[model samples]
Target: MKIDMSNLKFGAVEKPEKIGNEYFAVVPYFFTLKCNVSSMNDDMKKKIGAAVIQKYGKNNVQYLAAEGAYLINARMRACAISPDRKTWKFVILEKEYKSQLVKVLPKKILDKI
Candidate 1:
């Protein structure tokens, strides 16, 4: 099933937190994409990473090989994992600090993933 990110709403903001002299607002938004695949491997990672780079630009996307994840930006990430041997799960989360919220994921990106 395809998700329409524009229709998805943000959850309630948490209580503000103070660090030193700065106060920050924590707003979290997340979504999951499920795929039926035989396995989650390096080739799959590259394909997903390429889609992210194409959408967000190469300079904005960082791949963490050790974590098997892509940090899409300072506030967002798309991580792939296998719950068993046949299911592939992409957990895309945008948890922004200081109220700089990321409210949508592009349909093109979703289709690519």
Candidate 2:
């Protein structure tokens, strides 16, 4: 089933900034579920990253992290999915916060990936 996006509302995008050698941008989150940032296990982190990719796409998804480690996935970067905490903050030097365009993607869009 597809979600009704007629009333979609996108959250605000934060100003981009440079940290060390990377540029990062924050956007108002679009997800409905989030695990505690400081309490996730490796499996939980992967699942969270996957949930984001399913809604945003692989190219749009970036860093995946738990409390212990951070994993970077680049097919050469961008994806978002859930709760107010379910947002991506990655090496924005070559990435874009596509969440400014829409709240959620449809099944057909997810299938093409």
RMSD each, Å: 16.0, 16.1
Candidate 1 residue 55 C-alpha distance from true site, Å: 0.5
- How far in Å is the alpha carbon of 44 misplaced in model 1? 0.9
Best candidate, TM-score-wise? 1
Error of 2 at 95 (Å): 25
Over 3-109, each residue of candidate 2 has an lDDT whose tens digit, in order, gives: 22222234665455444343444434333222233356667767867775775677655552333333323232222332233455332212243343333433322
| Tens-place lDDT digits, model 1, residues 1-75 | 121232234556444434333333334444322222224576776687677677667876666556555655422
Segments in model 1 whose C-alpha atoms lie over 4 Å from true places = 1-39, 74-113
Q: Which consecutive 10 residues in model 2 have the weakest lDDT in total? A: 1-10
Model 2 regions more than 4 Å off: 1-38, 64-113
| Candidate 2 lDDT for residue 108 | 27
| Candidate 1: pairs in clash | none
